[model samples]
Target: MIPVLFLSTVLIWGTTWLAIALQAGPVPVLVSVFYRFALAGILFLFILAVTGRLRLPKREHQVWLVAQALCLFSLNFICFYHAVHYIPSGLESLIFSLSTIFNALNARIFYGERISGKVILASLLGISGLVLLFGRDILDADASGTLTGVGLAMLGTLFFSLGNMVSRRNSREGISPVFANAWAMSYGAIVLMLLIILTGTPLIAPPDATYLGALLYLAAIGSIVGFSTYLILVARIGSARAAYATVLFPIIALGLSTVFEGYVWHWTGFVGLGLALLGNIVIFAPSRRPRRTAPIAKDAETVASS
Candidate 1:
């Protein structure tokens, strides 16, 4: 079951990167994102309702839900969607692999949690890996698009980390993620709709068969089923082990990107990929606790003395 859950999540999420790539033509980023989340959000609500798990958040909690909607569903995706236009899907996924590091930092800032040195080390490795992978683009004066994409991807990961912070609070307050997610996604869609209206963007149907197929795949498989199975996987094997899926999925995304997008991989990029994955593994790897020796019991001492 764990293996199934794990494999399903990796495949679903990995392929979603390609789906996002396929969504590049015709539709505006905001509209495409709106379509993805709105469809998924509706299905999320339906599933929750059918399962008798639909619970609206309290008034106070609604603010957090809104914050989550903006961070996770709206702006977070806006960055990713925009970034994909400039970079390979696999590269973006590789950059996003830093969400674990971002989450740890955000938690420390928001909740006064202590960060371990291991996390710091992991951050260095991951960031260094990214530098190696993109150094040529950064050095090139003409690669403005690449730079923009990298910045957007980093920003998107930061937003994702912030959303995770909100989610942790919601979870602690006994709000089922399934329930909170339903409302957040609905709120996200509503917000996007409002944005569309305010910006006077035209509503267009999926312009091509590929676009339509990608949109539906992202909504149903990537958003709904992927999230559901991942949550269950986290519950069963624990978050640490489940997080291993993160490291695995980017490889799949990169493989697909190579086949579909004609992504060229320099030799250094492979080394960078290894370091980035290693860093994440280091972040989640179980810490070795020093075992304390037990003291001799008083009764045993007395018996020996006597």
Candidate 2:
């Protein structure tokens, strides 16, 4: 089951980057993202309504839900899309993968979760590998603008971590993850729409079939279906385990790059990919022994009485 979900996410996400690469012209990256989610949100809501699954979340859940939408659905894409303008997508993806470390840290800080030594060591190894893989890109003078773009991707990851926590909080209250996500996407779309209108960004008529095709793919497959699968995995396994998929998806992205963009991986990139994969494995591996459960001693008096 895990493998199925992981592979599905990897394939969908892997190919989606191609669609993103096709986006051209002065259409602000944010506007492109706005269109993706707004259209996706509407379609998702329509599906939900048709299936008798749509409804408003409680007022108390609204703020965090909206925050999740902004973080996961909106600004995250804005950051990544705009970042691609300056950075090689491969290098950008390497930076984006740091979300694993950020997620672990955030969980520890906010939830009092213990950070295991294995997890820390694995994360360090993976990061080091990524640095090696993209070291040239990182050091190149031509990549200066991309340095800031990488920073934005990191910020996007932080927002995504926040969104994860928000979703967890919602689930703890007995709201279904799917329900929360649907609402979050809706709110995210609304926020993006408002931003678009306020900025007076010209929504040019569909430029061509290529743009329309890309937009539809992003809206349906990327936003709605990909997210829905992720949420389901989160519910089925656990958040941290589900997040391990993040480890695999980037490799898939790299594979796609190689096939379509003529990406030629050096030895360093291979080493980096290996290290990152090992880190993911170590992070998600089950403990040697379940944390020992203390046995409850039976009272002699109670036994005698019985």
Candidate 3:
């Protein structure tokens, strides 16, 4: 189940960036995001209804759920899609790899989880690699747009990290990840819809086939299925571990970008890739000590009988 969830996240997110890339022209970024989650929310709600799995949460949980949706479903994509126009998609993905670092820090902040030395060192390595990765571009070019892109990417990552924290909290409260994800998505869709209307952004109608295809991919595969699995992974594996998928999935996105978008890499990019992998290892490496098991006690059984 773990491996399957990991691979599913990688594949779905890997390809979805290309779909986002497709929406770049003739539409407001918010409109693109609005269309995506609105459709995705509807699809998820429909699936829940058909499967009889959708249940409304208690009133008290609504606020956190909405915040999760705004962070993950709305702002995360808004920042990312806009960022890519400034930074190369590969560089954006690399920036996104920092999400694991952000998630670890957020876990510390929200849950009082101890920050491991290994995790901090890993974050430094990853940041250094990113410096190397963007060395030429940053040094040679004005980089006004690119720097802005990097900033927005980081902002998007922060929102994603916050969402992870919320999901983790909800999980601890015994809420199913799916239930949390479903409601959050609905809230996000509503927010996006309001943004679209207020902005008066005219939605672009692509070729009938292409637009529909992109919508379906983003809505069903990318948003609903991919996000649901990711939430489950966060609940099960700890957000720090599950966020490793962000690091791996971008490799897939970078590959696709190279082939389809003619993204050429320099020596620095390879070095950055190595460092990113190392950082991922550091962040997720298991502790050395084995967990102790309780010894079976015969007296405990006697007490139970009594």
Instruction: Please report the candidate that would top lDDT against the real structure.
Output: 3
Q: For residues 35-100, could you state the per-residue lDDT of candidate 2 as single tens digits?
A: 888888888889889999888878888887888898889888878887777777667777776766
TM-scores for every candidate against the unseen true structure: 0.83, 0.87, 0.86
Sequence-dependent TM-score of model 2: 0.87
Best-to-worst lDDT order:
3, 1, 2
Identify the runs in model 1 with alpha carbons over 4 angstroms from their true place.
Answer: 1-9, 86-91, 130-142, 145-150, 228-248, 262-266, 296-306
**Ten residues in sequence with the least summed lDDT for candidate 1:** 234-243
lDDT of 1 by residue, 201-298 (tens): 88888988999899999998998888767656544543334544655677677678679767689998799888877876786678998764444476
Summing lDDT over every window of 10 consecutive residues in candidate 2, give the lowest-scoring window.
Answer: 291-300
Candidate 1 matches the true fold with a TM-score of 0.83
**Lowest lDDT block of 10, candidate 3:** 133-142
* Tens digit per residue, CA lDDT, model 3, 1-306: 987998899889889988876766676788778878888787777888899988888988888888899889998888988887787765777778788788888888888887778767877777677666656555554376867888898999999999999888888888887778777888898998888788787766554566668878998899888988898999888787788788777667767878997778999889987887787678667778864544346667768899
Better of 1 and 2 by lDDT: 1
lDDT at 121, model 3: 83
